[model samples]
Target: MKKVRGIYIKNSAEIALMREANRIVSVVLDALGEAVAPGVPTMRFEEIAQDMCRQFGVQPAFQGYGGFPYALCCSVNEEVVHGFPSRERILREGDVVSFDMGVVYERFYGDSARTFAVGTVSDAARDLLDATRESLHRGIAQAQPGNNLYDVSRAVQEFVEARGYSVVRRFVGHGIGRKLHEKPEVPNFVPSGMAGPVLKPGMVLAIEPMVCAGTCEVEILEDKWTAVTKDRKLSAHFEHTVAVTHEGPVVLSVS
Candidate 1:
């Protein structure tokens, strides 16, 4: 691998290692998604993620990274991102929970996130989830060679706004490879006067979109980790680690 203008370009070998790392992330997330229920404690998902990481012989990428204590980030309704998993936080009917997870294998990192409804939810909550998820795919579709990085950002922003939703500006997507977070901060909205870097082959990015049913502004809770919407309204998050290749964007974080 080599760094060009602060962005790391992966070789074919390195990309293969990263694929394995991301596959582990996908497997663990699938398990967590299946375990989401109305009565389960949020911490149970963390335990399941840790066990899967051990079974796959990989490391929990978030654990101890910047002092994060758990393997998964369980963001409940109104929580935007980085919510700590806890036994005290129980899943309830009509609540939407977002699970953000990552794993490391052979020194490469893979990251992904998904928001799941606890049970039957309000129609507004369901619409928010659908729009947020669709926006993620729209962003990923723009991850191709010769496209400006902001192309992906614009795609996400436009889609979310068209549906009457707001994108979380404070937390953006990022590059991922040997390190969990890399250069080329991938914002969901395009900032004025910034064109961003050109997409190129071998560039891997974790494209995540956190959408809010209310205002885009958010505040960190007393825990200093959980971020909640200012209006205490519904929020949803979706993510996928994608690779820019000769053939276009290939989603790496998939089973």
Candidate 2:
């Protein structure tokens, strides 16, 4: 590994290990997504995540991290992120849920998120999910060598706003590998007057775009971990672990 401007550039071997780590994340997310249904408790997803981690011989990265109690951040409806899973919080028809998951494999970390609709959702909710997912891909496309980090930020911001959604600013993405969060924070929106670091080969970034149908403003729930849209409107989130390579951006978290 090499550190340039405080950002760690992963070597070929490191990237390979990260690939396996992220692959596990993808598989787990697939299972979680498939399990979404009405009348199911959110805590069931956490149980599924733990079971999958064990079967894959990996460890749940979020469990106990920063005193977090659950393996999955199961944000429902207006909840933006860091949502706590509970048996009482059962899924209802037409609710949108976002599951942010992470895992540790051989000391490397993988992080990803996806929003799913429970049963049949409204047209507005469906649009939010589609736009959030596309925004993540747009940002990933900009993760190329010699490009400015803000380029990725700009892509996500513009694509999301153009679709009539607001990007959450309070919780941004970040570098991942060896640690859950690393140097050079990856914001969905570009900050004024900050160019950020130039993209380079071996740089791995967790590009997550959190979007809201209402205001971008966020409010923390009484639990202090769950983030909700201040206006109580719908929100969506999507993420992937991407690596900047000579050929272009490579998504490491795909199955």
Candidate 3:
């Protein structure tokens, strides 16, 4: 279903709490990023991330939320997102893993994701990740008051397609605050026709761009959560929780 929500701008005090939550989220990802290497088990990475969240007195936003069992979404290679962590699968050289995590502190939530290449990866895979990351930034640039949601989508779509890539249409970014997901569904690609309503100040959004190396089409695994490219090609994902302000779009989840 199409999601359209009005922006919910938080006050100064609420923004402060949200920043602290995001800071911990950043730390968790930093630890995970550093440990991402050949021979490391994804379950071990999840343990480290969960430990970090507990140390900060925060809760794993994904755990138990809509039946997501783990604290992190561990997607490796062809797996796009929501892959279950398992010790059975060890990280190998040239493999790329995407970690998507969310943390809640003082009642607010912060979510973000990063794709890391284990050891050395092929030029093609590296370029794919770079393009997806850049598309995220391009989408962020349009997140100001008075701009439509499609404006952000157009920026991301244009950049990815120009580079010979396509974005996953099934999942897109959404509003976030005290809850994991709120109003205003943010699409990474243009939604058939014109853009949605103009953006307004105080709206917090999680803008994630998932791009595929081949066709944009995707299929969910039998596991019922992990998504993968239908053509069996590679995909990359990058995300950031941003807030619209009079000053401009502020990326709250940057580490």
Instruction: Tell me each candidate's TM-score.
Output: 0.99, 0.99, 0.96
Collision count for each candidate, in order:
0, 0, 2
- Tens digits of per-residue lDDT for model 2, 1-255: 889999999999999999999999999999999999999999999999999999999999999999999899999999999999999999999999999999999999999999999999999999999999999999999998999999999999999999888999999999989999998799999999777999999999999999999899999988989999999999999999998999999999989
Question: What value does the lDDT take at residue 92 in candidate 3?
Answer: 96
Q: Give me the overall lDDT of model 3.
A: 0.88
> Over all chains combined, what TM-score does candidate 2 have?
0.99
lDDT over C-alpha atoms for residue 41 of model 1? 93
Instruction: Name the candidate that leads on lDDT.
Output: 2
Instruction: Give a tens-digit lDDT track for model 3, residues 1-255.
Output: 122354576876777777778878888888999999999988998899888987998999999999989999999988888889999989999999999999999899999999999999999999999999999999999998888878999999999999999999999899888889987788888888555877877788899999999988888998899999899798898999988888889988865
Q: What is residue 108's positional error in candidate 3, in angstroms?
A: 0.7
Clashing pairs in 3: 5-184, 9-202
Deviation of model 2 at 169, angstroms:
0.7
Candidate 3: 10-residue stretch with minimal lDDT: 1-10
Pairs that collide in candidate 2 are none
By lDDT, is 1 or 2 better? 2
